[model samples]
Target: MKNNWADAMRKNVHHLAGSLGNLLVESFHYLALFAIGGITAWAAVMAFLGMMEKGNITVDDILLLFIYLELGAMVGIYFKTNHMPVRFLIYVAITALTRLLISDVSHHGPADLGVVYLSGAILLLAFAILVVRYASSRFPSAKVPDPDATVKGALTEEKGET
Candidate 1:
């Protein structure tokens, strides 16, 4: 009986520790999400102000805005669905590279331009691969349905509804 009691206590402690760890991890995840959202907002506001001061939004400015938009979308989607699509990041990288190429065109010669173009092409290929991976079920995904949907479906089944 004493040994059984000790084992029960140990199991309870282990369960409590696991619960606490999960809580801590969830708290940190939300904190990081809020930080990302705040920084994205700050960047968007700064970009808008810069464009206002310049009196004209240049292509670089537009591309920067696109980057900000993609970042914001990434954050929002993660917050809602808890899934981060790799394609969004690839799109952001492509946009950033294109912006860099456009802004540095006057500073770079033919060879440098070729290198930049090649880099952009590589990014495009990565984006294509991600698209195909998502399009085909043969590739594994980290995405899962919302927990709320699972709960609702269970409740509906309990009620004898489809």
Candidate 2:
């Protein structure tokens, strides 16, 4: 009897510890998300302000803003669904590479082969995005049921619907 009691106590303690650890990790996860979202917003605003001050919005500046927009969208989606969309990262990479390629060409007159490499990289990333999309659609994972749908289902059952 003593050994059984001791085993129960140990199991309870282990479960409690696991719960507390999960809580701690979840809290930190949320905090980090908020921080990243806020920082992205701030940087985007600063970039816009800088462009306004210069009174000129170049393609590079626009591309940078697009990058920031993608990042903010990514954070928002992750916050809502707890799932990060890989395509957004790919979009950002494509935008960044395009921006770099433009800057390099404009400054260096396309004399070097960097432009070719950057264009190739952008093409590869674009292909990767397509592949990812195709694979996701082809082998879709189980999806979480919508909470609103669950409530609606309960209401329908209460009304004697089959």
Please write out the lDDT profile of model 1 over residues 53-99, one tens digit for every residue: 98997888998999999999999999987778667877787788777
TM-score of 1: 0.74
> For model 1, what is the C-alpha lDDT against the true structure?
0.82
Candidate 2 positional error at 125, Å = 0.6
- Clash count of each predicted structure: 0, 0
lDDT of 2 at 89: 94
In candidate 2, what are the lDDT values of residues 1-162, reduced to their tens digit? 999999989988986887789789889999999999999999999999999999998999999999999999999999998999999999999999999998888877744777778889999999999999999999997998865577678879989996
> lDDT score, residue 138, model 2?
100
After the best TM-score superposition of candidate 2, give how far the Cα of residue 158 lies from its true spot, in angstroms. Answer: 25
